[model samples]
Target: MSLTYTYFKMRKGFGRQPMFCMVKPEMVDNIMPDEAEQKKYCLRNPVNQESQAVLSQSQQEINTTRVVLTDTGINHLEGGWPKDIHFDDEETTSRYRRRIERDESYVDAIMHLTPKFEHYIDQNNAINMYDLFYKNMPSEDPVEKPIIRINNVFRDRQCRPTSSIGWTCEEDSKLVVSYCDKVFPINTPSRNTDLVGYLWNVELPSSPVDEFLPPVACWQVVCSPVSAPILLGGLEDGRVCIFDLRSGNSPQDISPEHIAHRDPVSALLYINSRLNNEFFSASTDGVCMWWDVRNISKPTEAMIMSVFSPIVNEYDLANAQPITTLQFDKAFPTRFLCGTDTGLVVNVNRKGKSHNEVMSAVFKAHYGPVKALHRNPSISKMFITCGDWRVNVWSDEIISTPIIPGQPQKYQINDVIWAPHRASSYMSVSADGRLRYWDFLRKYREPIVISRLSQHPLLKIKAHDNGQMIAVGDKKGVMYLVQLSDILVYSGNKDKPRMIQTYERETRREHLLETKIKEIRLKLTKTEDVGVEAPPIDEITEDFTSVESEYKRIVDEEVRNMGPGRTLSSSQLEKVKQEVRKR
Candidate 1:
C-alpha cells in the first residue's frame, strides 16, 4: 500500500488503540489537537478516565511553561537575523551561516495573532534614576592622612638582656629598662640609629650581702609622675629599691623598718596621677599594699586575700594569696583592682575603715593566674583581664560575667591594653607569639588584625599617648616598634567618627541602665519575704524606670535626626523601644 494511505489509516485508528500507539510514526503529527478535542478524547478513553479519577481523588497538578524573549533575540528577528548577532562564538557563527546558506529558519514558531492598534513606542528610550544620580552626585572626600612609617629601631647593647615585664617610656622619650642584675635608663635618639646611650644605671639591691644573693632580678619598675627623676623597682628578693636619677649612682635599699612585703613583687602601679607620692604594689604573697614615697617601711593600707572567708588576724600573717597585677580606676581614685595568681580579681576600696575591710568584692576572672589587669583609659568602669588561655572585658557595675568574653583555649594571653585614642578598640598579645587588634563594635568573635611577630611569646605591649605608635616586647629580649595606619589610629572622617563616638557613648549608657534595672529587680524579688515596706527602694525603682525611658527616647531621637535614609522604619523603631523598655 502507498505511504499516504497507510498514514491516513493509522490516524483514523489512533483514538481507538491503546495509549502506547500514540508514539508510532504514523500516529504522530506536527500539529497538536485543540483543547476541546483533547478534553473529549480524554473523557472517552478508559485509561485517560482512570487518570482523571485519580487526579480528582487528589489536587490536580498544574504544569506551566513560560517562554521569555530577550531584547537581543527580538532585535535579531526584526533585523533579518544579521551576522553581527552570530559573532558571539565561532561555532554559533558557523551554524548560523550554514542555516542561512541552506535557506532554513534559525528558530521555528507557530503564530496565533490577535489584531490590535499599533503605536510607535521606542522600547530603548527608558530612563534610569541610578544613572542620573551617578551623573549629578558629588564624590566623597578623603580623610586626614596618618603617619604609619616605622620611625626607628633601637637595638643597642645586646649583651644587656632586657625583661619584657619591666619597661616604660618616659615623658622625655627616654626608655627605662630593667634587667637581671641592674636597672638602666636609655635616651632614645631622634633619628634612626642603633646606638642607645645610657643616661643612668643602678645595681639592683639585695640584703644580707651573701655570695649567693639570687642575682637580684628586677621584676617590675615604674617612674614617679610628680618626681620624674625618681624610679621604683620591684625586686626578686621581696624588696623595692628606690633610685634617684639625679644622684647618678646605685639605688638605695628600703630600710628594714619600712619593708612591707614578704614575697616577690610581681606588679607595681602609681595609685593616682595627681598623687605621685602614693603607689600600690602586689606581691606573690597575695597582698596589695599601698605605700607612700616618704614611708616605704609599712603600707598605710593593705588588701589581703586568703583561701578562707572571715580571715582572722593570724591568717593575715600566715596565709597570703599571690597577687600578679594591680590597676587603679582613673575616675575613682580610691578604688583599685588586683589580680591574683589563683585566678581571682579582688576589687579593693581604700576608703574602708580598716585594712582587712578593703576588699569590697572578688571575682573568679580566669582559669589560671591573672597575668594582667588594664582599665579602659576612656571608660573608668570598664576593664580588661588576661590570663592562662583567655582574655575578657568586665564592667565594675556587673561583676558576675564579662561583657566581651574570649574563646581561644590553646594559647594563653600574656598582655592586653585598651587603645589610647579609641574607646571601643584594644590590642592583645598571646603566648603563641601573635598580636591581635580588636574593635568590639565591629567584630566580637574575631580580631581585626593578627600579626605573627616571632617564635618567642610577647610578654609586654604599650601604646603611645599620641595614638600613632606602639611597642611590643617578647621573651627573647627583642622589642618591636610599630606605627599604626591612619584608619586604625585616628577616628576616620567627620561623619564616621561622630557615628562611632555616638554609638560607643549610647552603648555604655544602655549597659549602665540595664545594670541598674537588674539591681532593682533583684532587690524587689529578694525583699518579697521580708515583710518590711521600704519607700526609698520603691522611689529608686521609679527613678530608674524614668531614666531608662529617657535613655530610649534619646536613642530614638538620635536615630531620627540622622535623617530618613539612615534611620530605621517606624515599626522597627517601635520594636527597639519596646525591647529597651522591657530591659
Candidate 2:
C-alpha cells in the first residue's frame, strides 16, 4: 500500500477503530484504568473479530522484530551501553562515552551473540567451569617469619627507698643529685635511660656532740673550677662542708667557730679563677664572707650588707639584708655584683683595702628577693635577674630602669642561664615545668623551643662551661642531665657569630679606656690639692734613670730562671730577635 493512502485510511477510520495496533505484554497491566467502575466496564465489553485480528497481527510483528548486532555495536559494547541510546545532548553523550571507555576493563568476561536459549545454557556452563578451576588450584607453601618483642628495662627495675625514681644516661654526661642527706653522681647518656645507676655517693655525717639536732641537708653544691675532684657544699646549719672525691672519706665540716654564717648558707661561688682555693659564701644572716680553702678555720674577709645612703654617707646596720646571689665581671675582675633578700643589688669593688673602704652603688631591682643572677659572657655590662615571677636584664650604666623590661604576670622564672657560646640565646626553667630557649636577637617575646619536664618544679640549674650540657635539680631531689643537641648549642649562620664577636671586642675596649680615664682623673685630683710644681731638669733626668732601673729589674726577675749566661740561649735569642723585629 502507498504510505499516503494508508495514512488517509487510518485518519478516516480514527473514530471507529485502528487498522493495526501494537502492544507489549508488559504494558497490559498499566493500560487498564485504575478506577474500579471504568475497569469493570472495559472488561465487560468485547472487541469484534476484525479488530481482534488486527491487534493480534500487530503484537506478533512486534515480538518478531529483528535486532541485528554489527561490528560497530560489538566494539562499542566494550565501552558499556551506547551513549546515544539514553543521552540526548551531543556534548553530554560524548563526555559519558569518554568516562565509560576510561573505566571499562579489558579483562572483563566476553559476551557472545547467540540465540536466547543457547546463550542461557552457555552462561551456566561457563560458571560451572570457573568453580571447578577455583576448587582444584594448587596451594602455595606458608612462609615463616620471626616475631619481635620489645621490653622496657627502666620501668621494670626496682627503685631505692630514698630515690623513688631515678634516670641515668651515660658516663660521658655526668650529673650530680642531692637528696635528703646525701649527694651522688649519676651518668646519663640519653633521655631514655633509667636513672638507677650511682657511680658514687656520700652521706652527711651526724653531729658528734649534739645528737638531738636534725641532720643538716646539703642546700647547694658547686664543683671547683680548678680541681676536678674537689666540691664545695653549703649546709642548712649555717656551716660549709668540703668534699674531696679523691680522698673517698667523709665530708669535713669547717670549724664551729669559723662557721660561714649564722643562718642557712644559701649560695656559694668560686671567687677567683686564678686562686682556686678562695671561694665566697652568702647566707640568710645578712653577711657574705670570703674564705680560703687552705685555711677554713677563719674567713679572710667578711662584708656585712647594710642599707647605705650615698648622699648622707650614713649606714643602717639595724636592718641588714641577706645576700642571695653573687657574680663577678670577667673583664673587670675587681668589680662584682651582690643580690640581696631586700630586692636590692650592690655593685662593689673588691680591690679596696677593707670592707668599710669598698665603693658600692645600690639599686632596688625586683619586687622580691633576687633568687638568681647571671652575667652575659660576651657583654660585661649586661646581666639578668630573676625574682618575683619576672626576669629582667640590666645595664651597668643605667640603674634606674632595665634594658629588657620583664613581662608582667607572665612566668615565674625559677632559674635562667645564658648560652656560653651564643650572645643572644638563653635558657630558663619556669615553675610550670617548662624549659624554654629564647633568642633575644630574633624574637624577644617568643621562644624557640619549650620542653615540658616532670611535675616537680626545678629548683636549681647549672650549665657546663663548655656549653654542651645542663643540669637541673627538682624539688623531689631528682636530677635531670640534658645534653644540648648541636643545633641548640651552635649557630650555623655565619653573620651572627661575627657580629657578636665584633660587638664584644668594641665594648671591652671602650670599658678599658673609660677605666683608664677615671684613674687619670683621680691622680690629677690628688696632685691638685698638693700644689706640686714641675721638677728641675736635673731631677727629671735622675727620676728617669730610676724608672729605667725599675723596668730592668722586672725584666731580670722574669727571666732569672734561665741558664746562667751573659747572653740568652739559642731559643731565647730567637724569641728576642722576633720581639726586636716587631718593635
> What would the TM-scores of all predictions be?
0.54, 0.50
Model 2, span 1-583: residue lDDT tens:
5556433355665586647778666644556556876556645356555444453443333466688977653344333446455544668778776776665462232222346668799889868654556667886634432121111011112222112111123333234433432232125222222222222221111111111111355555666666555666666567776766566534654636455577667678776667768888887677777888877877787766764623212334455678878886668777778899888887877666544445456767898989788888866677888888878777676556566766753657777888887777788877776677777665667777777654766566667666766665555544555667655676545636664564455456656766888899899888878998657799999977876666565447547766466555578656654554454
Clash pairs, candidate 1, are 258-297, 286-321
TM-score of 1: 0.54
Question: How many residue pairs of model 2 clash at the backbone?
Answer: 8
Candidate 1 local distance difference test against the native: 0.65
- Extract clashing residue pairs from model 2: 166-195, 167-195, 168-194, 168-195, 169-188, 169-189, 170-188, 170-189
Q: Any runs in candidate 2 off by more than 4 Å, and if so which?
A: 1-173, 180-215, 257-259, 273-275, 309-317, 353-359, 492-583
Residue lDDT tens for model 1, 62-179: 7689777776533443334565664656787778777766653433211212122111133234545356656677787466443334444434244333443322345544345554
